[model samples]
Target: METLCNNFPSKLTFGHDAKRTLLVGAFALGTYQGVKLTGNFLAGVWKHLLRPGYDLKKRYASDSSECWAVVTGAAMGIGKEYAKQLGRRGFNILAIDKDESEMEKTQAELSRLGIKVKTIIWDFGKISNAESYEAFEKELKNATNGLDIGILVNNAAEFQQESLDMISVDRLFRASSVNSLTPALLARYFIPKMLARYNNGLKSAIINVGTNAAEIQNPRYKFAVYGASKAYLHILSSGMREVWGDKIDIMTAIPRQTKTPMCPVDYCFTATPRAHVNAILSQLGHESETYGTMTHDIEYYMRFGMFGGFVIDNMIQWLNEGESKKLISAYERRMS
Candidate 1:
């Protein structure tokens, strides 16, 4: 009884000290995380909101009108806006797409901007074939002869919104070609030209359009294959930047939901094509990879933060459910 009484106070003090230490450590950890998030948020505001973009006209010497910007999928959506914006900045535009009528419209708009505009109606899906790709390369060279190609925008992509097993092999192949192979091959073709331009005291840039879905660490539910293809694109962009970033301005513009034909709904976070393109262009020469908009930057941080996986998973599930309902309703209406 004497021994127990003698040791009780010391043992009690040790337990109390341990609990207090744990509490202090947890508080310190929470404070560090909070500070990190706050710093990141403030930096994003400065980058996307306050900071001025690099001057394209000054950088490319717009007075000459010899610099050209080639844009794929330039008939509509984000690609169309990129063509318009680059043309407005005095870069001649080479617009490529499968839709002849749409491309004609885009060409007309670009011509009205007083910049040279050329449209090529080629099926991106066809470029999967070796001979077709070689032919396309020859066409590109012929079309841009006597022009300084300053920018190449790889913006064409096939969006697949189905489960992996449900998607057709042809569809997946086409997506891989458009989202993965096309950008890689186009970069290979353009890097030499851009480097040559660099040797001649000119600057060039390549912008590869990617998807935010590819950045998620978890497997995307309905768009796994699509995400995987875009992930390959993201990696390719990074590698190219590592190699040629100093010589040429190379960047990957990753956008989330946007108001385009592929995603028609105007959600709260969805940016218009013009807004998204403007944000992306503004970030050029500053960042190797960008989310393309302030809204998207926030969304990216939130989705990847601690406790973000649970929320994002639920949100994706809800969106998938909503999509299924829409498809079912359309089917029923057709049957009726």
Candidate 2:
């Protein structure tokens, strides 16, 4: 290879890497030459591999969106799911999230379910006072212009892992605005519209994404402020259900640790945004999972109550052990 390259025009090999590239190109002109140029060939290939912008095209689904059923946090995790799930049940979806790229991916997934979609990328932080509601109405007026929605899912919430005592007051307010205030504002704004429409024999529903972390006091997940805020969410949902008087369907869901970015990977990622959307749709179709289980309340209690505590206690122990599988098994048997 060196002998043959020595014979090539010297000008073609002016620079360091340029010389090597020219030699390799000459060698590729024949199999005998390529074999003689093993070191150069491999070196050239390796250099190209190391360089960026050599990315392969990813095979993808046809990207599409549904212009109805607006869901917040509609990017990579659970919120990304509303479009797909709702679309399957014959509702168009308006998937909203902070990440436009991921939202497009989710929109494509839902579009496969044959639903039209629209997307909005906006920040929705909550406030404690009545002004929160006004802000939500304004946001709605901005993002959704004359769009009809059979369902609204407020699935977006800000999350982080700083010690509650250490985070500043401004940080605290920011979280309160994201987790508690935004949902409340959205509920306040959307429900009245839903109620007026419901009188015309249309049934509209609202779902507030609640949490299991708020149910316990723990050291590992030091979101004390966030936990306290979630308590307000739980109470607010119950109050809304009571006060709304069945005119608007409201449901609160406490999904276990999902495999979302905000959550640690140690926990199971079952309750995706897609699953939540499906649960809502199933409820709408009048299945046993719908709205309240006034009919199945007795059986649900008998079945889930006993094991729920046991499962929770053991899970807490496992996650606290740094999500170690070995520690979890030991903890489970010990609990048994």
Candidate 3:
């Protein structure tokens, strides 16, 4: 560094003496043989070691770097988009679907991105015979070596055109199960393990895909039965956000009628599922988070993507010390 400091004037004497003093200060008494390093060299080495990509930093160590993201309904539509984007970001993907063929197709897609892919054929619409937690725990074992799930996206859903009066009790339950109940079960199934991992201090995220119908209150797009089911999902998600601590991020995105299978032919053109995928990928795991919007359509206009994050974050911080009611009240108040 003295040689590197050639441009300094006859402060050369000061530099030389300072280097000698630091060199002497390095060892308890004196220099080790003739090879002595100045304190400046030690500070430089410390800074370099802490810098990004340094081997000593361990930023990319297997323990820190591997991410396992599991997405439901990932065979196509928004879920498929989530899987591809996450895989492209180097996350190993575990995708699930009732359709074995589509699961296989996503496996191929993830593979092409050089991401290790695992396909689990399970129907979230039906509760597992085993408890939901055990079922997911079992699936996690089949997917990865341990319990470090980086993210979970609940996206599997079905839509119908039938009116509430025309829909049967069983049929309503079926649609409800696909859109709401399964997500709750998957949350119950995944949250304990997620919390445990987070308590042990892991970085993880949970994304619940909600619908704009939940925001509109008794709207008529997908179906009345389905809309009411999604309304239940909104309350349930807010409750989960309450329990998942700050270290673990939990968010529900409400995208409107989209060019996706979740909506029937009538609603596709108004919403673009792919564009919403970009909006969501931009929001996830980004320390800058967004929150409290009943609809993703409104989220598009938020400048503080990081704002409202604390709405949930504060709840997790004090462990049941916060409420989504405040957020809900504010959003609803704005409507009038």
Candidate 4:
């Protein structure tokens, strides 16, 4: 009795008047908020306009001989870039990834910088259930054994674009686990260590890379789980930072589109991984959350500030609906 159409339901609807009124209200709110936020945006620009400044250099100019940084998904893209930049900053790196070959490449590259490079080869996707998570926890403990980790970048993520009904339950589980659970667990594991360093007057930082997908309204194209998981990260970072702000510098790096293997499109706004990582690194200790790229920061303000939340929300809904239809049709054609 199951049909392809049944798996891909029709898009939701709002009558014409309702939608019109909503759009008008959203645009109005956006304009007002945009005007109000312009001041704060300008202030941020003034503060961070200069990069790799004397103060920034001095802050991170520690001997870093005993310091260590742990980067998840360190095999490629943003994670790899983070590892490379951190290594160059004089911190020994613990690079974690399932791709042994890519990790080897990463290790070889970082080794040239003369920093100690240790690799942990493990699949974050295998962690689909409680038992598996426990095993993963143990495995992680063994991998990080005898290491003093000062920085943790919870960057590993699972992104599968599929409709809700069409997606297999197992796929959903994997996406949720890697996107949210892994980061949450890793944060829990490393935060105490960061705090412990506080007594010694040493500072530690935890960076969580978040996505604008969290702000999108009614995410379609099978992005429901991904959006929700990223939203969880931002919320988690905010709350945790409130409680541990004095002890450890917890930051949420909200990145927009960047040129990574994971992203399907390479739009003009899409920042190169190096550019994005460099922007983020330069802002360390200056802000708790950042767009990490100048273009993204402007995009964020325009989308949410000028266009307003309502406009952004409605645009996402419309776009998702269109994309979902195209994807569903393509999938059905393939199946047929």
All candidates: TM-score: 0.88, 0.62, 0.62, 0.78
- Give the number of the best model, judged by lDDT: 1
Ranking of models by lDDT? 1, 4, 3, 2
lDDT of each: 0.82, 0.59, 0.61, 0.76
Candidate 1, poorest ten consecutive residues by summed lDDT: 323-332
lDDT by residue (103-203, candidate 4, tens digit) is: 99889988987978888887888877779878877877887776667788989876656767767898788777888878888898888777777776667
Off by over 4 Å in 3: 1-65, 128-141, 144-147, 264-269, 285-336
Error of 4 at 237 (Å): 1.2
Listing every candidate in turn, what is its Cα RMSD in Å to the true structure after a full C-alpha superposition?
4.7, 24.5, 19.9, 10.5
lDDT of 1 by residue, 1-336 (tens): 999888676544457889999999999999988898889989998898899999876675435557789899999999999999988877888898988998888788878878789878887777777888999889888887887788999999877766688777888888888889988888998899889888877888999999877976643546678889989999999999999999999989987778776665544367899999999889888889887888877766766764445687568556656654454344345446
Residues 202-307, candidate 2: write the lDDT tens digits.
6666777766556553323555666777667777877988887467667675555455655534543334544444444444422212212222222223223433
Off by over 4 Å in 4: 1-41, 51-65, 216-222, 307-336
Q: After superposition, how far is residue 331 of candidate 1 from its true place, in Å?
A: 12
Report the lDDT of model 3 for residue 19: 86
Candidate that scores best on TM-score: 1
